[model samples]
Target: MTGSSSADQTVSDAPTAPGGRGLSPSALATGGLVALVGYASSVAVVIQGLAAVGADTAQITSGLVAVGFSMGLSAIWLAWTQRKPISVAWTTPGMALLAATGPVAGGFPAAVGAFLTVGALIMVAGLWRPLGRWIAAIPKPLANGMLAGLLLKLCLAPFMAIGQAPGLGLLVLATWAIVGRFARLYAVPAAVAVALAAMAMNPPVSGALPADPWPTLSLVAPAFTWEALVGLALPLFVVTMASQNIPGLAVLATFGYTPRVPPAFLATGFASALTAPLGAPTVNLAAITAAMCAGPDADPRPERRWQAAVTGGVGYIVLTALAAVTATLVTRSPPILIEAVAGLALIGAFGGSLLAAVQAEEERIPALVTLLVTASGLSFFGVGSAFWGLLFGGAMHVLHRWRPAGA
Candidate 1:
C-alpha cells in the first residue's frame, strides 16, 4: 500500500506487447539490470554485516556465495513454478540490523544459530497465517523508526570518512552524487566501482586478500545462545518480515500478480536455513528489484514477466562466481572507506525510513522514542538496542492509545 501506488500507475500506463507469451529481449535486459543493480548496490553492506558478526574473510566469502546461490535458486524456482515475477534477495535491512548489532556473545557461530532461528521462524510464519499477520500488523512508524535507528551510524560513515580521509571519501561521494543525477539506480554501483579502484591502487596494510581467492564454502558449527536468540534472531526476523517480505509481496500485488504466499515464504525460509551454516544471514523476497522484474519494462505481458525473474535468477547464479573477488576487495579496502560506500548505498533507505518514522503525527512521539533509543545503542541483559527500542516504542504506543474504561 505504501510503496505500491506510483509504480502501479507506471505499469498501468505502459503499452502492451501484442505477441505470444515468451521470453523477450526486453525481459532479458531488464533482468540483467535487476541483478546488477541489486548486487552492486548492497554487496558492501552485506560484507560489513557479516564482518560485524565476527565472520572471518573465508567465512565472509562463504556467506556471500551461500546467499547468492540461495536467492538465485529460490527466485528461479518460485518464478518458474508460479509463473510470476517472484524475485528473492538477501535481506538488506536485516543485514543492516546485523551490522548495527555487532558481535554477539557467542560470535560467528552463534550468529549462524541466530540465522537458523530466523529461518525457522519464517517457515513457521508461512505455515501459520496468523504469525505472518502479526508481523505485518507491527506499526509502520515504529518499524521504520527501528530501521532508521539501525541505519543512523552507518549512514554517518560517508561524512565521517570525508573528515578522516577527504580524498577517498570525496571521490566516492562525488561519483555517487554525479552518477545519481543521471542514473539513480546505478549511483551506488558507480561509487562502488570508484572506491574499489582506489582501494586496489593502494591497499592498506591490515586489508589483505586471502591466500586462496577462489570461493569455497566453509561449514560453521552452529552455537546457540540466549543472547543471540534474544538480541539477534528476533530483531532479524522482525526486520526481514516487516521491511522485506511484506513490501515485496505488496509490490507483486500492485502488478496484479498474486503468487501463492506460503510457498514463497517456505522456499525462502528453507533456503535461508540451508545456507545458514555457511554463514549467510537470511534470504527473502526483494521489494525494489521485484518492481524491476514484474514491471511492464521487463515485458508488456504480465504473464511473461516471470521470465525476467528467471533471467534475473540466472544472473545471480552467475554472480556467485564473483564472491571471492568481491570479498577480497572488501577486505583490502580501508574499513572506513568501504563503510562510506555502504553508507552511500543506504542513504536513500535512511531518508525513506526517517520520513516514514515520523510521518504519522499521532505516532510521532513513540516513533521518535524508538529511533532515539535504537540510535543510543542501549543494551540490557545481553539484548541489543533494536529489540529494546521496539519494546519501549511499543509500550509508549500502547500507553498513548489506552483510555479509561467506557471513556
Candidate 2:
C-alpha cells in the first residue's frame, strides 16, 4: 500500500472524465482479486472476534453475512455515486479489539448494544466536524500504543499454537512464512488454506454442520450496559476511526482521489447502524483494499478505477454465501488453532502498531504505559483494559506536558 509522491503525480496526471469512463477487464479482475484477498486474509479474525464476545454460532454466522452485505453494498454505492475508487470494509483492528476484550458484562447482547453505540457515534462524528476532529486529535502514539497492546496477545498465538499442537501449528506457520517470502499479500490466505485443509482431514468432535449452510439475518436484541458502553463501544469507535476510516481516506488521497469525507462517513455509519441489529459491527472505508482498488494495478486510468470498487463490492456479496461455512468450521475447530491462524494474520499489523506506538521520543513513556497496561489485561469495575490503558496513557501525556507556569 506504499504510495510515493512520484506515483501520486503519475496518477494525478493521468486523465479526466470521472463519470463517462467505461468498465474494462483489468478493473474487473482487480476488483475480484481485491475482494478475494480481503475476505480470505481476515475472515478468520472476524469469526474469532465474534466468538470471543459471546456470540453463538448462529450469531457469528449472521454477523458474517450482515457485515459482508453492509460492506459490499456500501462500497458499491460510494464508488458508483462518487465515481471514485472508494472501498468499504469491516474494521479489522476493531475486530482485534473485540477478540482482546473478550466478553463484556452482559454478554453478546450487551456487545450488540455497544456495537449500536459505535454506529451512532460514527454518524455523529460525520454530522459534526468537531467530534471527528476530537477523535483525530487523540495522540497517535497513544492510539497506536493501545492498538499494539490489544494485538499483542493474538499475535503470539502462532508460536503458542506450536506449543499447543506442534504439527498442525508448524504446518500453518510454515505455509504462511514460505508464501510470504514470495507473495506477502497472499501469505495469510495461504496459511488459512493449509489450516482449513488440516481441519477438513480431521473433523472436530462437534460433527454436524448447520442444517442449512446458507447464512440468514438473525436479529439480536441489544441491551445497553455501562460496562459495555465504557469498555466496548467507545474503544471500538476510536479504533475504527483512528485505524480504519482516517487511513482509508489518506490512502485514497495518496492515489489522487479526494472523496467527500462527510458523506463517506455518513454512509458507512448509517450502514453500520442499520445492520447492527443483525449482528454486524461497524463498516467503514478500507485502507489496504482501497489501495488495491485505487492503484494502477486496478486500472491505469484513475477515472475508471471506480469500477474496481464496484466489482469488489459485487464480489463481497457473492462471498456472503461462504459465511455460514466459515463460521461452522471455526466453531468446530479447536479455539486455539483458529486463534493461531488469526494471530498469523495480524503479525504485520502488530509490528506496524508497535513501531508507531513507541516511535516518538516525547510520547514514548506515555505510550509505553498504555501498551503495558493494556497488554497486562488489567480491568476494574467491569471495564476492560483498553479503556484503562487509554485513560492512563492520556493522563501521563497530559501530566508530561503540564509544566508549572512557563519553564
Candidate 3:
C-alpha cells in the first residue's frame, strides 16, 4: 500500500528461478491457470458481442488477437514493473453490453469508434487525478456488491448447464468440487480441462476453420456519431471502470497489494486505443482472476507473487498465436457448457465478493441496493446499470449518513 520505490526495488531484486532467475514454478502454474480461466471461459461472449455489432468472422478473430496481446502485454509490464501480481483482463460486462446493445446506428465501424472513445475515457481518467480519485472513492461495500451482481448470473451457469447437458455438466461440477477439496488452486483449471474434453468428444456442428490458422488485423476506420458514442461508449466506459477497474483494485487491496493505479489504467487505455482499430474491446485490471495470482497459493511470499501475473502474460502472448483457431473452436462448442465451466470457475470469486459486500452492518442496505440494481440490468438513456447502481447506492448512502439517528 505504501508508495515506496525502494520497496519495489527490493522485491525485484529478490531471487527466483524457472524462466531465468526471476520466475518460480508455482508462479508459472498459477499464471497458466489464470490465463486459461480468463480466456477459455468468456471468449465466446467476446465473439458473440463482436458479431452482435455486425463484425465479420475475420474482424472477430482479429479482435481476439488484439485483445489477447494487449492484456498479455499489460499484465506482464504492470506486474514486472510494480513487482505485484496485477493481472489484466478485458471487461466482461463491456462485452455483455455490446452483445445486448446489438448493432448501433452506424454498425460495426461505429462500435469501433465507440471503443476508441472508451479508451480515451480510460486514459483521461488515468491522467486526471480527480476522476480517478472519484472512482476510487466509491465505498468498498458498494464496489464489492456491484462485482457480486455482475458475477451472480455467470456464477449460476453450472446449474443451468446441468439442465442442458446433465451428464457432462455434473461431471464438470464434480471434478471442480473433488479437486477443490485437495488442491483448490488447480480445481477450476482441472474443471476447464474436463469441459474442453467433453466439447472435444461432443463437438458442435460448425462447418470448418480457416486454413490460415493466424488471425490478421483488420483495421476498421472509425465512424463517430452521437448515437454510437452515447449508446455505446459512455456505458462501455462506465462498466469498464466500475465493474472492472474499481473492483480490480479492490481485489488487489484484499490481498494487501496496491500498485500504482494511474499507470495500470494508462497501460490498458493505451492498449485499448492501439487495438480499437482491430475491433478489440477495452483491456483493464482483472477483478476475478487477480485473486488467483495474488493469493498465497500463487506464492507463499506475497512479494514474489507478481511472477505469476508475468507468467499469465506470457501465456496470453503464447495463446494469441492460436486466436483464430481458438475462437473457431470455442464458438463451435455448446455455449451452455462453456458458460457452466466459467460459472464453476468464478463461484469462489463470486462468494468472496458477496461476503465483502455485506461485511459491515451499516453498509448492508446500500450494498444490497447496488447489487440488485446492477443485476436488474436496468438501462436508462443508454446508460448501463452498473453506473446507475453506484449512483443510486451513493445517494442512498449520503441520505442515510445525513439523517438523524433512528429516522
Best by TM-score: 3
RMSD of each: 6.5, 6.6, 5.2
TM-score per model over all chains:
0.65, 0.65, 0.82
In candidate 3, stretches whose alpha carbon ends up further than 4 angstroms from where it belongs are 1-24, 104-107, 207-211, 223-231, 381-385, 405-407
Evaluated at residue 399, the lDDT of candidate 2 is 99
- Model 1 steric clash pairs: none
Any runs in candidate 1 off by more than 4 Å, and if so which?
1-20, 130-211, 328-407
Question: Number of clashes in every candidate structure?
Answer: 0, 0, 0
Cα lDDT for residue 176, candidate 3? 89
In model 3, the clashing pairs are none
How displaced is residue 166 in candidate 3, in Å? 0.7
Candidate 2 residues 294-392, lDDT tens each? 766566667888898999999998888977675555555566676676666556555655676677799999999988888887865434566677789
Which residue pairs clash in candidate 2? none
lDDT of each: 0.77, 0.76, 0.78
**Positional deviation of residue 213's Cα in model 2 after best superposition, in angstroms:** 1.3
Q: Which is better, 1 or 2, measured by lDDT? A: 1
**lDDT (Cα, tens digit) per residue for candidate 3, span 305-355:** 888999999888888899877766666666778777767756665676677
Those runs of model 2 whose alpha carbons end farther than 4 Å from true positions after fitting are: 1-5, 9-20, 130-211, 327-407
